[model samples]
Target: MPSIARVPSVPAPGDAAELRARARGALLGLAVGDALGAPAENLKPSEIRARWGRITGYVTDRPSGTDDTEYAIFSGLLLARHGSALTPAHAEAAWHAWIADRAEGQFRGAGFSERGTLENLRRGLAAPISAQHRHAWSDGLAMRAAPFGVFAAGRPAEAARLVAIDGSVSHDGEGIYGGQAVAAGVAAAMAGAPPITVVASALAVVPDDSWTARSLRRAVAVAHRGERAVRSAVVIGGYPWTDLAPEAVALAFGAYAAADGDFKEAVLTAVNMGRDADTTAAVAGALAGATQGESAIPEEWAAPIGPARGSCLPSMAGHHVLDVADLLTPEVEEGVALVPGTDLEPATDLVRETDPLRHNAWPPPDPTVFVLAPDQDEVRP
Candidate 1:
């Protein structure tokens, strides 16, 4: 087992409300991005352009999140119940209880990674062995990683650790790295870190030599150049699956970096890039939202995002992102009055001080070719 860092203490009462709002922004932004990008998922950029012409807003008449939002809800509720003590066993059990053990009708909008995991579980396989399916490296884990960041608040390392625990039940290698990057980025954003710092926090958690890290570095390096450059830098051309963990995670972070943490631009950039649009946009939305807070999200964009309809996980039905945010945020004690001018302590006091980008070498190593998943006719939504 990897040595874990100390978990940060919960925020002070004055900061609690602020943290809660950011958490709400992170989760709500995820749902909004997921819905807005759903219509563009699996389509090529040209196809998306032909159909919706840049997807400035929802393309569908009644826009709603697909598997992305529901999976985040599933992870959020599980994190709420377990807190920082979550383990691989707990995650596996939850899969069995809330997913695999349920009737066939209950499993509706699950992505390939999830469906594969459920099948393996029903066949009596336990994780990380159960995670051996072909699509184990999909962006499924990355899509749900924001909740760990929301729960850990300013603690990026701890957030990464917790998300890895969650991912262990269904992902491996680049898949786990993808989730770690997203979680760490969101955690840094929650701490009010700048966009560069947030990206650095993401790079800190995973091996620098991994495909996910390499692609992320490439994407962020050219992010300022423009969205097209960033997408072209990271996307693996000719890969059949749009949900490749390394490519999607890089594109999402690149979008966030390109927009400088602006919620709308970050999500819209990701959505228009087209590959795994829902997951990438959801990740970008979560990072930007955590940084900017709920009020930063456009009112009209926020309006359509109601409680999740359990399109993917039936056990998560009727649970709104706000509800999960509230659950993840620690509440102030009753009757405890907050000092109006109380200076909130810096997060450095709670978390260990370490160079987040120690492993990031300038001019990232030459890109390495990886084995792509076997081409399948059905792409994950």
Candidate 2:
């Protein structure tokens, strides 16, 4: 669908090795959170308690990620190919080539925003126009925003800008802002920023008066009191839809704040909150994981994440989150392409130029920083 064009890698600022670890942590943590929260999505906190006494770990015997993880892998692949030159046209084409044009069976578990965008695309509507739907304000974009952060590591503003381009085809207004917040937070975390700084980075990206910003402020303000306080401060009870971008993003940031960037605590808190649990937990997991690195995630939690099942986006099936992480922050040497199908002929130049985000910089500053190792395992742990 969307080809991996010749993206000249420039050397980026910061520790390349550490950036690689954080990138791995962000995507892997997202998969873990998605799998852990899948069984608890949409249920109220009380209902969740009634079903499974505060969900501390994977509920199912064969735990696996949902649409949240699949969609992230989809976005990460696109970012790897296009780098900073990604546009709405590229995103739309990828959507059509990898998703909308395919003869999928049932389109299981996709959110309304995705369905609406696909419908519009089939009707010949372009982006910004394809994004015209009632569910355009959902958390769909936020669910896949982490890759932008990984790609534009250390640059919160750049991460926000890139995610907005990706979201333009399926989200608008608050939806776009929510994605930007998550992207900015993860970007800051990737650079080893602390939790407070991560939150500040998120706030710095969106308009101060926007609903997403306000909700984030309220949630973080009450985060010290714990998840329940954070929930009460931000969540609007009886709102019917749990996928609201503002509410979900707030809950995620609140969980991250409450946990003080602890990978286990942040993810578990988000999972227990119940509203859009998968997406919220995924976002929290990405933020915290980036802050703490891949080693921070529990081995038990990391073990369950395998190649995506691709229940939502079939083209993404068989692709592992680790592989996507490697692709985003690649450290390959010589002519071998990080990804299989792509042709990266200039092996030495590719090795010399590892940072993909360099081209996306405002004035083209310095250079920077994928592929999975042959561990032969389900997860890294």
Alpha-carbon deviation at 14 in model 2, angstroms: 8.2
lDDT of 2 by residue, 1-381 (tens): 111112112223335567788999999999998898889999888999999898989889999988999899888877876676678888988888778888653454399998888899899999999999999999999999999888777777778888999999999999999999999899888878889989988998898888998999999998999999988888877678889999999999999999999999999999999989999999999999998989999999998788877677777777888878877776645444443233321212322343222234322243322222210100000
Q: Write the per-residue lDDT of candidate 1 for residues 77-161, one digit (tens) a residue.
A: 7776556667789898888777787763344537788888888889999989988999888899999999988877767787888
Best lDDT among the predictions, by candidate number: 2
TM-score, prediction 1? 0.85
List lDDT for all candidates, in order.
0.80, 0.82
lDDT of 1: 0.80
Instruction: Give the 10-residue window scoring lowest on summed lDDT in candidate 1.
Output: 368-377
What stretches of model 1 exceed 4 Å from their correct place? Answer: 1-12, 104-109, 334-381
Reference-based lDDT, residue 361, model 1: 35
